[model samples]
Structure formats: C-alpha cells, structure tokens
Target: MPSYPGGETEKAAYDLATKGEKLVMDYLNISIFDVQEMPIDLYLFFMREAYIHGNMRTKEGREYLENCRRMEQTKPDRKKIRKKIQEQKREG
Candidate 1:
C-alpha cells in the first residue's frame, strides 16, 4: 500500500495572501486598528505564533485519526471475549 504523508504545510501561501492576513487577524482577535498599531516585528511574531498553533492542532488531529485507524485494524474479535459488556470494567 502506498503511504501518503499527512497534514498541511505551514509555508506562507502568497496566492492566499488575503486569506492569510484574515487568519492572522482573526487569530489575534483584535480590531484592525489594533493590528495596524502593532510594530512590524510584533505583527510578524503573532503571525508566526498563529501558524505554529494551527499546525500543532492539525498534527494532533492527524495523530488521533491515525491511532483510531490502527486500532480499528487490530481490534480483538469481540465474540472471543466471554465477559458480558456490563461486567467488563470499573463502572460498577
């Protein structure tokens, strides 16, 4: 089976400049005036942080899904376990 590397790239997309700007703006949760008031360095710092957090979230999501897939492929045959479902765990 061919394996595909998952998750999106964090590289800035010049073609989506407007959308990127909007993302940064929304990430900061501040008004346009506040954004303009920030220094270039500060703005860049926040934008970098936004992308970092977005990438981390995507990475975690992918890992969770991959784990789920692996578990599905390897689960024990339920019928082989004689224990009643209600007696299986500590909920009692």
Candidate 2:
C-alpha cells in the first residue's frame, strides 16, 4: 500500500478498497464476498491507492503506485466462479 509520511495512508487504503468493492459489485453483477472475500479487494485497493498517491508525489510513492496500477488493471476471471455457483444451485 502507499504508506504516507504520516498516518494518512491507512485511511487512503481503506477508501480505495471501499470504492473498489463498489465497482466490482456493479461491473460483475454479483454479490460481495464475505469478510474473507474482502481481502482480495483490500489488497488490490491498497495497490491502487498507493499508485495514485505516488503519481504526484515522491519517487518511492510513484514506484509503488505504478506497481499497484498494473495490478489494478487486471480483471478477475469470473466465468469459473459464476459457473461454480450455478452448479451448486442446480445440485441443491
């Protein structure tokens, strides 16, 4: 995550994740995973926040942000997960 010089980084990370979850839910047309599922979102979000912070700031921040941007640009493969959910429903 983008560690700010002060303690602001934590809050920035949290906000990034929260926004990411919302985007995921909307774009994927699925329910948010439980607490356990949120970790993925949190991880990706931290990277994204770090990247944004890095872009206009220090060199370290920029490097971290670039890495995060690369990660955030990736889309999750939902086909398998959706298929699995469908199968469970069929069996149940």
Candidate 3:
C-alpha cells in the first residue's frame, strides 16, 4: 500500500471505494469481517460502481477516507511482514 499522492482527488477515490464496500456488504447482509474474504470480482464491481456513481463530497465519505488512507499505507507492509515471517520459519 502507498499513500494517496494525488491529494484530494485520490482521497475522494478511496472514500468512494470505502463507501461502496460498506453499501455492498450491507446490501448483502454481511459483516465487516466477511468483507476480507469477499470475492475480488464482486468487490471490484461494487467499487467501480461506487467510484462512478457515489458522491464523494459527503461528510461520511470524507471521514471514511482516513480508513482508506490507513489501509493503503498498511497493505504492502502486511505482505512484507508475512513474507518475513515465512522466511524466518523456514530458516528456523
């Protein structure tokens, strides 16, 4: 994951994606935890809809953008950490 270098526009995109995910989950009667295991195709479809149709200037949208930023920053780190753990286990 990397920072939203595009500033407000990138933030808006991330916010839209978050809102889209939530809406999809709620519509499907799924919990937040279940989202992690959601099918990528469905996720992408929902996110695309969100970006294309969602209003990114709303208050909730802005608030959730922070989460988007945090997730972006940590995504790559999680993979790297997992790889490191696997390497350590192999060595040990």
Identify the candidate with maximal lDDT.
1
lDDT of candidate 3 over 41-65, digit per residue (tens): 8777765555433435677565556
TM-score of each: 0.43, 0.24, 0.30
Identify the superior model by lDDT, candidate 2 or candidate 3: 3
lDDT sort, best first: 1, 3, 2
Give the best candidate by TM-score. 1
Runs of candidate 3 with Cα error greater than 4 angstroms are 1-17, 46-92
Which consecutive 10 residues in model 2 have the weakest lDDT in total?
A: 4-13
Error of 2 at 46 (Å): 15
**Reference-based TM-score, model 1:** 0.43
Q: All candidates' lDDT scores? A: 0.62, 0.56, 0.60
Please give, for residues 1-92, the per-residue lDDT of candidate 2 as tens digits. 43423423444433454655555555445565742365676647654554464355777666655555555656765897799999999999
Q: Each model's RMSD to truth, in Å?
A: 11.4, 18.8, 14.3
Residues 1-92 of candidate 1: C-alpha lDDT, one tens digit per residue: 11124433356645664554565688988876787788888887887666555645786655645554555565675764646664676467
Q: How far is candidate 2 from the true structure (C-alpha RMSD, Å)?
A: 18.8
Report the number of clashing residue pairs per model: 0, 2, 1
